[model samples]
Target: MNTTHRTIVSRRARPAKEPLSQEVIVKQAFLLLREEGISGLTMRKVAKTLDTGASSLYVYVKDLQELSSYVLDYALASVKLPDSDSEEWKNNLFAALISYQQVLYKDPGVAELALTTMPLGPHSLALSEYLLKQLAASGMQAASAAWGLDLLLMHVTSSAFEHVSWAKNEKRSFTLMKEAYLSADASQFPFIHSHKNELFSGDASNNERFLWGMEVILQGILKQDQ
Candidate 1:
């Protein structure tokens, strides 16, 4: 007769699980967002990742929405900001926003969160404060600064989303659209036919186009203040 023997590991010998806390829960959720994207981030998944019951997560987070806000804010912690007293305030502002865009560009889930969730956390507040201060230094009125901040953030978020979407195998759709635009009937769409090359001039991989758009928006805001 053949017999099988196995060693049983004692629970006491196992490593202790990390203590549950709001920060831990949020970090786990952020991990899920990076690994499995926005769709995979949930209380149940975060609880599973932490080796705990989903109900336990409720003690730390109110709901998925609240947790998403926390996760978004957590991800924003990596964004680099320039010195407050930098002489090149405009360039500094642009650099800060570009840093923010690069952060979102790294993960499609983050871009989605930036567009859909308004994170009311310290990191989010810091980014907003930094941008507002930069805008103020440029002689922007309070109203313009506030509204321009929204527009600037929206542009970066949307641009990141579009770039990520294209990178994630959506290029076929873009290609087909470009072909359709380029092949438009000259008699029907004269302008599109004439400017087809310029229409698709800059691809998403180029930062020059993004910077140009930023310049246009900044110029508009500055002019509005005048």
Candidate 2:
């Protein structure tokens, strides 16, 4: 029986999956940002999600800021620039701004990153160059176009962050917070109580409010050129 028995040997276990590339690491970071707020995102957490060690991440991203820069650049890439010959510059610009807001809204924590960082990567530079070109084509002087693009980008980032804050707090649900705001003494704050309807008229109407602001800015820019 001993001579008839043959042992079957199994091959060595497959090697573990290769560590993520820098781009994959950064992409996962953005996913974590969207899943958990910015405060929840950490190098350790990112590594855990990627099934790798934190040391593996440092090979690509130097620090949190660099990771953030990557995420912002990726997010900004979603903003599509209009064709060079497209005549509706204002409309195209407006579309780009709206698209930016949509991207931020889809990933609220991204707004936080976008607010603190300046776009410096190829993706960012491309967007900036495209915007500047669009503005210049619309008859804006080079300096005005450059500065205007800066102002508009700043405004979008700030506004998106504010919206993200509101979304995070659930302040849009006027049912709970609205009552507190309305309960304030009418005599001391007549204006506050009087405007409660307008202040919290509809819950979760950020899209409309954002569009209104965008229109106002677009109008101002158009008027300046006219």
Candidate 3:
């Protein structure tokens, strides 16, 4: 039987039998996540993987959400944020964002967790503070900086996760999208048809697109200052 379908009892009634630590639980959870992705990382599944009852896991982890928080915290703690004190705030901001996205790519679904819950993990808070500091020093108002942080997180997480979804689903989405774009009615989408090449042109790297998007955001922020 698949491990997921195997019958497992909760430890609430039975005494805990596993001699594992929270560290071990977190480590094994990471493996499960890497092997099965988010949907496969569950408290019950983790207990089965660890050869313990589902209730035993509660001693180390409250729920799947808390388990995810632990893993995300452990992952973020290892990343080195770009220097947050640079006078060139725009450069610093974009570099930090790129680094953040790359880190998210290291383990899929962690970015979505961060984006939705905005967890107060120590490392997450540190990055948030760094971004706020850089934005504030760039002469952005408190309210604007607050919203700006949310905007950047939403953009990076959504964009990177979309890439992950495409990879996971084995979707040749862009090629199909290009075909549709190029085949659209010429009279209705004259400009889109004309610039189809430029619009669809990319060498499978999001770096240039990301940089351009950041530049546009920075320009808008600068306008707010003026």
Pairwise lDDT winner, candidates 1 and 2: 1
* Greater-TM-score candidate between 1 and 2: 1
Q: Please tell me which predicted candidate would have the highest lDDT against the true structure.
A: 1
The lDDT, on a scale of 0 to 1, for candidate 3 is: 0.76
In model 2, the Cα lDDT at residue 201 comes to 55
For residues 169-199, could you state the per-residue lDDT of candidate 2 as single tens digits? 8676745777877786899889988897788
Top of the candidates by TM-score: 1
TM-score, candidate 1, is 0.94
Model 1 RMSD vs true structure: 1.8
Candidate 2's C-alpha runs over 4 A off are: 1-12, 172-187, 190-197, 200-206, 219-226
Full-model lDDT for every candidate: 0.91, 0.77, 0.76
lDDT, model 2, position 202: 40
Candidate 2's displacement at residue 199, Å, is 4.0
Evaluation by lDDT, superior candidate among 1 and 3: 1
